[model samples]
Target chain A: MLTGQLIAAVTTRGSGASRVIERDLLVTRNNLMVFVSGFVEPVFYLFAIDVGLGRLVGDVTGPDGGPVSYAAFAAPALLAASAMNGAVYESTFGIFFKMRWGKLYDAMLATPLTPTDVALGEIGWSQLRGLAYACAFMTVMVVMGLVASPWAVLAIPAAILMGFAFGAVGMAVATFMRSWVDLDMVNLALLPLFLFSATFYPLDVYPRSLQMLTQLSPLYHGVALIRSLTLGTIGPGLLLHVAFLAAMAVVGGIVASRRLHEQLLP
Target chain B: MVARGLTKRFGELTAVDAIDFDVHTGEVFGFLGPNGAGKTSTMRMIGAVSPLTGGTLQVLDRDPATDGAEIRARLGVVPQENTVDEELSVTDNLYIYGRYFGMPRAQVRRRIPELLEFAQLTDRADDKVTVLSGGMKRRLVIARALINTPSMVLLDEPTTGLDPQARHLVWDRLHELTRQGVTLLLTTHYMDEAEQLCDRLVVMSDATIVAEGSPRELIATYAGREVLEVRFPPGHRYAGWTGLDGIGSRREVLADRVIIYGDDAEQLTSAVTHSGVEVASMLVRRASLEDVFLRLTGRRLIE
Candidate 1:
């Protein structure tokens, strides 16, 4: 029976993970308006700031040798931010509501699924969503003549990695939240990360210590790595960013799964 | 199945005390109790959703502590609270749950329509669960539980919130499952439900089984062959009732009436009236599970 349950857990997680991915990608009738709604918010941000506001800011120096428009400079960062936001949204509020309000996990656990299965499935869905957003955003970047090389393809995987880090960390934090009021703190943490991750400007403008601090931000690594690749500025620094994101994914996954098991099973 | 000295404590509250019992295969067994009687807690342990604080329990000849997942896979459970996912359509709810049991997509596709029909939900298969009424949702939950075709089904207060019609529908489905040789374990506060569905039952109060027998056996042993109820005028008291001591073994004083237990209510009523006990109303009824419950616990069953 134990073996059967474990197998069932694996399959259930796989199906749940797939369902989450499909909910984002598929244009089902019930979700069509919501899908269109998500696009407009980011599109508005892209035009209002990247195009409308960039006219006042002028051109900026790309991390590489080339000079690029401010709009182009900010676009990738917005895309990276969107990736992070999508992942965190799915992992935190969505997961927390399902766990608490919907009692979805409780129902599943009554069957053969375990907390580990749920953690893996939720993270898997977030990563799949992250990759989808990255691909869509990259397509937009390419149409704007901002993507300079095939190297930009790496950003898709980079977005997925960023998703793993954020999703795992977000779910871990969600497990600690006792009510909806605690979600404000989650928003507080996210807003700052969005505004200060050098997503709108180059990090060199800040103090040396501030620059180091920015480098420590997970989004900064995402923005930096994607920024470098889109401009064909590949170097050893790519390896550092990749390693940081990978380590974050591994460590965050471990922490999230452990905490989830403790909370749900114990 | 066996549970020896099973106990569960949540902090300072002992939900289930040291209780011992066993359920044999192929019989309908009931845990009869009132609300807050530790029935749900004991069922949760048996369902393997909650661990036993201290004791030994085995389901299907396997320890639930060590083989919970395995045991759970073969067991069907309908919890007191409806845990159906509201976002999914009724058909999706069953299909997706079957996937949770590792049923092949093809098998689920084949079985989905039949299960929906069996649940009397074929017409609502495409509707989201949020749109369904309470009874429909509860029925959907039962359908979801049956997706894996379990050997044993556990129903905890299955009809607690349903209307009479919906309750009867659920009972019919349960009857079908039992007729197919599925072992059933049910808990309920309804004595009629127990009498109708249970081949055997255990009455629980304060977290322990106080009596166990078939419904009829309990009715005979605990209550008697028959019961006689005599209601006097308002504010009237029993007088000279000691003269009717030879009629039955027990008597109950209720707010509206006085109930006397005896094999012959007609003879008892004649004796009581002849003894100068003025009766405003009189009723004669056979012994029921409710009477057995009242006799054992010294309280009304519905209370």
Candidate 2:
């Protein structure tokens, strides 16, 4: 309920943001294949985990230090990684193209839609898409009997919160990018987060100081939160992860809208 | 719309410099200037899309700084570029833009067919916008701008790159708009376009308005009733006949031709010929807005 109020307050700057989402839906409806491709990468990784990696590794130590199947161990991390990857791509590539080549925002701002509307609408779209990816991945996890807890349902919202953080921050990063050359840096940033956020391994694999440093990665928080829920390791520590992602969302949203306002209005 | 010393600057460059103009209801006003005359900059300000660097601007009787979204809701803008949604079908472009104004879907749906008809893209309503011709695309943009039933519409070079037929089609549609009591503001480098549609206009140059009035008023003030054109052969130096000074109210000499502005072009022509000046060719024509523009800005082309 508090998260709902926070969203309502932040998005109340303009009423036209939903129109941006409506337009994106209109466009995406025609190109459904492109939309589905973003949700498939993590599913492929889940397939690998179930059919090949899980058999090789047998049971691994889960977030709760209990023996959990390798598929369950990696599924939640893949879910979190997918949320981050989907949002980062959607916000960065999608927004950069629309703003630069398409001149879409110029046309939008000519109407009643403010910069705040454009920013929030795009981030919200990414979040919803991330929600869909989360549900599908969770269903696969459940079908494979990886579900050890009913608390795993909370993973969908956690994935969406991850989406909000990564999407808004990715959008902020996109506003500062001038060309594809600058956008190449996004991969340089995300690849490290995906591989090193303890998605395929545990945090203790890194040196003590390195493990501490990895905790600073936003994706690490996402992995920790989703892994704990999917493994049924509920704890008070979960609030810290929720707060971190929420704070990132708010700060990223402000920066993205501010930068876009300057660029569009100036 | 009212503006008082409105200014817009980009870094060290002043795009619009201390210009003032008023747009009354139901009038087809125009801003005429070549490229870099700050016409688009002024239009963007009045459209409430860009903030002023200094000075005050009021659109729809409200300050643009504080009430831009409210002002923009009622102001239609057809930008110089046809910023249409190529991904969507013709009606979807109109529908989505109307939604941007917070209009209900049913209202937007009911309004789409009429707008497409006005833009004359009714037959192509179901097609993707990418398939439309240039003129059709331009019209679609104009139609999309009208989705909210804006009280005032801003068109930046609405027909800058169209062929003669397409230009006339746009002009006809704009004329029909004026008939419906919709106020229109347009910017163009073409004087014929301004003279054709503008109830009144301002000619801007180098980031400032140099002249403002009706076309006839400007021509009579700056150019005289008629002009006599005396063309000289290439590489020939202009021979200023002694009688040239007294033949017309004013005279302007260029590399290829000499122009004399006067009430009677025939009398001016006879006076120039009687002075024993061997002219390659000569013609008499009524003074036009082009003459007024040239007189005010200069004969040199502004890139």
Candidate 3:
């Protein structure tokens, strides 16, 4: 019976995702400029890190414990951070506006779509946009010769997993927000994760106790996964990062879907 | 659609008390009441979005509890608030709404122009919805509801805030849908709207149905054929005005006017005039659903 219910849930989620995609297609057709502008933020970060910060930081130790330029070390972490930023922006700000102000999900619920469908569909759209940004960032990395190994191709899927993890948790958090002012809490939580997830420097740069604390942030696992893949640092420890992200995606997705169902259905 | 002992509660507050009603295919059914009369709540239940706190509801022969999505698949809903996408153009709103029902893309494309023309919005098909007037938006919402060619449609206060011209435009489109044999269920506080559009209606007050029948039948049963309204001079107390006692079948002395309800207004007016009660002004008019509602609830419909 549980398996049957699970299958039904999956089917409705597919239906909901398709419905969202249809609406997104209409939005994209009308606002092509806004859709293209999303790629600009990460590119700006890349330029800032390569030109301004590269001169200050010089070469850093790569994931394989070898000397690599600051640009190459920072590039993959920026990709992971951009993935997190994209997913959180879409699932939190975008979903929150639609749920609270636009009342879009209210209309969708009046149809055959369930809250699970809405949650999955929104997360799917976020991942799609995140994937595009990741691909754009990776292309820039390739052009700049920042990608050091063929294993970097695997980072694309890693980026998607990172987006799923952040998107699910962001959506769950959005359900708790009451008004525009409540969004400050989201920024308060996310800015720290983005800044302190070892994105700007190696984990060793932090004190021993702070390094342990950094491991608890979801983005740290994402940053490490991408960094190792780009640096061709094949190690069994990479499995722990994958496992952490996978667990986050599953648990966060379930919590987000349940919370959305409660908020919207009620 | 059928509801048996239907009830909805928000914690300790009962929004809809136990009520029974059925909607037949190809007919316009209305729920008429003042604000907070459970009309929207009941409509939400029938739309298969709001869960029932008590009793049973069936839409399109399926229970809303487990078969909500199945029922919604064949049902259309025009929510009390406008849910039209402000960002999308007129045609895109209809197209995307149709897709929500899983309508094929080709079919939705083919249906857009017909819906636009039906809504009299062909001229504004490419314009964004935010640019449309209030009446245009109401019409577009109604058009979007019909995108799926639903078997039954639920409209919660379809013209609550529209001006007369817009309301009439919406009424005309709704009439067109009923003529095409689409079953429509709507809720409204406007007595004239109920009389103009609904073939049959139920009067709701305090979360319960007070009266139910065809509009004309409700008027005949509760208000009679004609009403005589007489306003005496200010401070002219008519507490002991036995003058109006034997003239009509029923009488209500409000602060502003004394209303006499009967089938023969002329005879009642003649009786009142001969009774020697000084009257500043008197008028007789055909009874309306407003009179029925007032008679049943002892309050004005619009107030």
TM-score, first chain, each model: 0.87, 0.94, 0.94
Tens digits of per-residue lDDT, candidate 1, A89-198, equal 77789888988888887778777755666666667666655665677778877887777778888878877878877887888788888999998888998998999999
lDDT of 2: 0.88
DockQ of each: 0.37, 0.78, 0.70
Better of 1 and 3 by lDDT: 3
Superposed on all Cα atoms, the candidates' RMSDs to the truth, in angstroms, are 4.2, 2.8, 2.4
Quality class of the docking in candidate 1, CAPRI style: acceptable
Q: Give model 3's docking category.
A: medium
Give the alpha carbon lDDT tens digit for every residue of B232-279 in model 3. Answer: 887665642556677799987676788899999889889888988888
Residue pairs in candidate 3 whose N, alpha carbon or C atoms collide under 3 angstroms: none
| Predicted candidate 2 versus true structure: per-residue lDDT over B25-106, tens digit per residue | 9999999888999999999999989889988888889999999889999999999999998789998999999999999989
CAPRI rating of model 2? medium
Candidate 1 has an lDDT of 0.80
Each model's C-alpha lDDT?
0.80, 0.88, 0.88
Candidate 1 positional error at B107, Å? 1.8
- Each candidate: chain B TM-score: 0.95, 0.96, 0.96
| Residue-level error in angstroms, candidate 1, position B235 | 5.8
Superposed by TM-score, candidate 3 places the C-alpha of residue B99 at a distance from the truth, in angstroms, of: 1.8
lDDT at residue B132 of model 2 (Cα atoms): 87
- lDDT (10s digit) by residue, model 1, range B120-142: 99999999889998889888988
For model 3, residues A72-118, the per-residue Cα lDDT tens digits are: 99899989988888888888899889998888989888888777667
- Cα lDDT for residue B146, model 2? 95
